[model samples]
Target: MVKFEYAPAPESTAVVDIAPSYGLFVDGAFVDPADGEPFKTVNPATEEVLCEVVAGGPADVDRAVQAARRAQDGVWSRLPGRERGKYLFRIARIMQERARELAVLETLDNGKPIRESRDVDVPLAAAHFFYHAGWADKLSYAGFGPDPKPYGVAGQVIPWNFPLLMLAWKVAPALACGNTVVLKPAETTPLTALLFAEICQQADLPPGVVNIVTGAGETGRALVEHDGVDKVAFTGSTEVGKAIARSVAGTRKRATLELGGKAANVVFEDAPIDQAVEGIVNGIFFNQGHVCCAGSRLLLQESVADEVLDSLKRRLGMLRVGDPLDKNTDVGAINSAAQLARIRELSDIGEAEGAQRWSPACELPDRGYWFPPTLFTGVSQAHRIAREEVFGPVLSVLTFRTPAEAVEKANNTPYGLSAGVWTEKGSRILWMADKLKAGVVWANTFNRFDPTSPFGGYKESGWGREGGRHGLEAYLHG
Candidate 1:
């Protein structure tokens, strides 16, 4: 075989100017945390130190929540909905203008391919703001009754996988509904959130309308547990989601959680094989499979299981897995060492439990966290890899004897976040969509997200939707 190599086409790092250190963004300004520890945020792709970020504590969370409360009770609450919408419009425009810079910074901090950060994450974030901006003055007609009111203060905690986008998902809707927010970006990817704080400043948004607190679980716990906050929004692991649910058990506080998923991608025999293969590759490999709605379980009809597996393996071999900055790269570095270790642990268990582990021949960079696009065949529903959320570039392949069996296997897991159905038969697609327990089902596609669509999960996948008109309800009271 003749090998072909392409020239390096890496994105320029000069586009994003990272500061040596950053502070918490509270009350619309960047300030040093009071008696708080500082931690380093690194580039997962290179294990290089990106910047020092403050680790907010209970007191810091209190300060942020107080600021948000003050804003919600004063300036923001008094502002007209049209005026509030104008501010969001300005933020959205600023985000669009600085999209490239934010995209580069996100890729640096998040270790996702620059292609995704640029094309998907950043744009969708801006779109979210744009979409919600129009709803600010129109909430009365959103079918939430004539006088839907904003929840006073929202304590939002976002995951690192899609930092800015998740921030937009939580913050945009809250602000549009006239709520003030104290947002905590995930510890590993706090830089972009801080940058977004700067965007809020540029938009001249009211002081304390949006506050950014950078920290680990303790800071998040304090914020959510604070009595001052009227609403809580979180996107992360299901275990933590359950913890948040329990923490707010007796409180009057309302919470919305978008949690983990073990989505099943069902491919029927009548489907378009090539497109199905592409969707399968994209579902598990996109964002290094850090997505909450990743199609990690491959459920192929028994008659075509072998053919689909062969195509999937061959396609995986051609995937470019290296520097995330490379324009040609298809798969990028794993988000962090801890996530990579977890993926490895689950994969090892899969092998030990009589499943066949297979990965393409791809060279990983020596200095950074990396995992090849992997698949496990002969995997039963009982296997740990098949049951748990790996949150990495891993897929578990299972054969299904019929449509009923596929639905049964798909709904067997505890997660109900998302699923994919690939079939040319419209009736089968409709039937599968109705039967699957997941919140979002993609027919012949996978991982398609839109700001206009309501996205969330059922059962253990968490409560409430994060997009479209339905998202506003979480931040409002009738």
Candidate 2:
């Protein structure tokens, strides 16, 4: 067999202008951190330092919380619903205008393929604002009783995987519900959040309406534990989610967490083989499998297991693993060194635990953190890869003999975040959907997201929804 090589098709980085260092965005302005500790953010694709960002500490969190409270009590709370909606509309439009720049910046910071950031993340981020923008004036008819009030100040901590999109998920709804927010973007990916702060300024949004504090987990903890905050929204690890729950357990703080997952994508024997194979690849390999609700476990019916695995392997080989800026690249670099280490450790465990590990022949870039699209066969329910969330470009293949077995194996884990069912039989799809213990179940599809759909998890995957009408409940008062 002969291999074909293609020329590099890289997107321009000049679209994004990075400053030497960035400060915290508070009260409609960028301010230096009080404690003055700064951290450098890098491009995971090249390991080059992009810019220095302020490491927001407790004092910074307090200041942001106070600003949000002031906005909630003074200007933002008094703004009429329709007027509030107009602001969101303005934001959505501005996001659209800067979509390309934001997408490129997102790919730079998050190490995801430029294609995904441009096509999926940026568009969805804008859409989230647009979807909730319409709801601002229609809260009375939203089935949340008459005249639902906003939670005073929401503290939102988003993960690094989908930085800007997750920010949109938290900020758009909270603002639509008339709540003020203090958001902390993950330390590794703070540039886009700061750019969003500039967008807020361009929209002429009220000072303190949306404040962004950038830092690591400690900053998030401070924001979540801040007494001035009335609502706590987080998207990260399950351990951190549980900690947030405990911290706000007896308090009046309303918390919504979107955490980890070890999702199962079940392909029945009667399913379209080609479509199921594509779904399997998309479910696990998209975003380099960094997604929280990623279908990391592929469950194929025993009868069709060999055929599906062959098809899946062939498809995986075709995936481009290289520069994220290259439009043709399918799987990009891992988000960070720490994350790459974790993926390596987990993949090693999968091999050590007596599972057959396989990856297509692919050459990774020399400078960046890269992990090839990998899958394990002969995986049992007891295997570490099947049980734990590797959160990388890794998939575990398990076989089931019947529909009952598939359902049983799918729900066998502690996670109930998301699941996928692929079957030509509509009845089996519906039955599996009902039986699977997950918040979101996709029939004949996988990893599909929309601004108007409620996306979240059950069990240890976290609580509450982040999209649509149900998402508004998390930031509103009864």
Candidate 3:
């Protein structure tokens, strides 16, 4: 068991130069927005203003897009594969050296627990860069013809949940495939990505290879719809993803989306109850359930529901909830006020739809957005909680009698992004793995990710993979 050290929570300060309220990173340098409009980015835990970030309007995105075009035309696209690989290796090394600072920045900007930002997000982000760098010179083995070429100026829009990690997932492969990039981080969580621009400069990467534009939905639309961009990669709500799909339709733009999911984590009677309970907790509440592939549904065998719930509830009660920077905190504040309301509205819908609701007995922060770890029992396949992606630390519990029933319940949702199975029987694990339609399946373990693994949905979850050799194809075309 990992013992979380309790430390005194620190107060918020507005004037710390430790992190910058950055502008758009254009041509290896930070530049002010063309419109001169700036927005304040706040620390969600205390609602303290962290920095005044420049909001990229259409003109700023055009500048960024044009810069990316120039970089792709002049340098990155024509660079030798080995040289590109070396740049990625340098960035990966820099990421590892500065991992701690990036983690704190991610937690401060995105409102996830510090432990996750440190242990999961930062390391995985670096690993992604390392893994993809190895593939730069070996694109011939990637099964996409003998000679694959980079798609110039990829316009990638990533989510607030895993800012730095998602940036690596998108940027690493694009760089590996020899594409310049103009990425827009989520409005709520753009700090770590902006900080990454400094890492690029430190690595001595050429100008316009990466540009970070910070703003809301309108900014994302401006980027994707812009003619200068050759490809669009997005990770966010399904509604917005579909809108992007429609916007890019009839155009020659290459697009890929890693959207929302309502993943099910099944615990069988033969499973280790304690371990499964912990996996369940980690799966759903790791980032306060702000994950796209979060195991929001729990399908327990009828014979062991009581024992599993007992173990789960006991474990839930012991979780520390407070300031994100506190190492002891298991549950942190919601990313934004909008997300908190969505969680609340969904939980209320679960209750109104006749599902029993339960939350961990814990106090939330007095300021900023907060929601306790929640669970809903009596959730049928028809329940709103079962069907909808309540992207919060809320779990929906359902029961099943047989393996067939378990698979049936697990595959009931439109999303096939991810699923988890906990069982002592090896045969059952294999059987369930074949049956589940999710892009990624976890047998016993949940929410585990590696840089070399392929991750994407099979159905409405979206098309294409984000890691492994397959991830390179999205940015490549001969």
Candidate 4:
């Protein structure tokens, strides 16, 4: 018999010593907001005041843009691509060194399970830097012109879900390609990104190479509309993505949007039943189904629908949901009150729209914002649950008589960021992969991501890839 010892989840007693106020990062140092207004970032899980961060209005945005513009016109853009690659390499190494601390902060601020922050989120963030670092100097061979230039200054806005990882995705490649960045992390989860600002300083990255301005939608609007920025990258909702597209239309600022998704994980009759059950759990319940590419819809072959559903419910029943810091916890609190409301409203709509709703029989914590892992059966293509991005631990189950119907119903949504096909048949897997309209399709798996693989969507899911060689293109100008 083999024995394994598990380490207890680490705890942080050091009070989050966010100064009475945090200022915007400009020219490699923290400074007051140009507009002189500030906002407090709160811990959604406990509704506690985490810190007061700078609320950058138009003036602050202008200053941040000016800083970025200067860096692009001066040292950062002038640095050799190989040297830029070295900077990214150092950031990646530091990210690994600080993974545990970042994971704790992530769980505290964003209310996601620490296991995911430590195991999935932090590691992949570093991997993204590692993966893109190699491409900094090899841009000429990446299908672009032999001498691709950097987009002057990238104005980036990222969502609260996976805060640090989004920062890595947006900033790493921009830095690797020699473009300075003005990044606005989502208001609710600004802690990690602000900490990342500290890491930039520790790595000795050039001032203005990366800047963090923390605020709400208005902050994002200022950054996007700033004429000095050359490109804009946003990751959030479909409605917001379209609005951004319209906002930047006819402007010199090129934009890429990685928006919402209602991905389908299809289980054919031949799928490994046990494996499919686990995949289904991970697809929808992982991160409390806050994932944009969550398998919100489960398209099971009619023959095995009952069997798969039974097994899935059984597996879901065993999941532990509680404190995010507990390594054994499988799910965590909803990121915010607004997100919880949205999930509840949509789940209510699912029931009103005549789909049968089911949740595991578990006693949820009375304090933090929480939702039980939920599923809807008898869902039709016309139901709101089937069409809308619930973006919670909610799954809609529908059956298909044939593979064509599976693909049809899977791609029926306006968004198509990702999808999954589960089957033992090699030909069926390939055929399904070819027919699916999503940007990422997993065969015999669901919700698996690698830094080296490209990720994004086909339609309303948004444009441009996030990882891999293709990600570098977003920062380069012809």
What TM-score, computed on C-alpha atoms, does each candidate reach? 0.99, 0.99, 0.96, 0.97
Among all windows of 10 consecutive residues in model 2, the one with the lowest summed lDDT is 1-10
**After superposing candidate 4, which stretches have Cα over 4 Å from the reference?**
1-10, 13-20
Candidate 3 structure quality by residue, lDDT tens digits, 1-478: 3435566764332322454456789888998889736888888988988888877999999999999999999998888889999999999999999887888888888888888888999999999888888998999889998998888889999999889999999999999998999999988888888889999999999999999888988899999999988999999888998999999999999999998898989999999998999899999999999999999999999999998998888888888988888776778889998888999998999999999888866777689999998888988889888999989989999999999999988998899999999999999899999999899999999989988888999677988899987788899997
lDDT of 4 by residue, 256-296 (tens): 89999999999999999999999999999999998999999
Say which prediction, candidate 2 or candidate 3, comes out ahead on TM-score: 2
Clashing pairs in 1: none
Worst 10 residues of 4 by lDDT: 1-10
Task: Estimate the lDDT of model 2.
Answer: 0.93
Give candidate 1 misplaced runs (Cα > 4 Å): 1-4
Clashing pairs in 4: none
The lDDT for every candidate, in the order shown, is 0.93, 0.93, 0.89, 0.88
Clashing pairs in 2: none
Stretches of candidate 3 above 4 Å error? 1-21
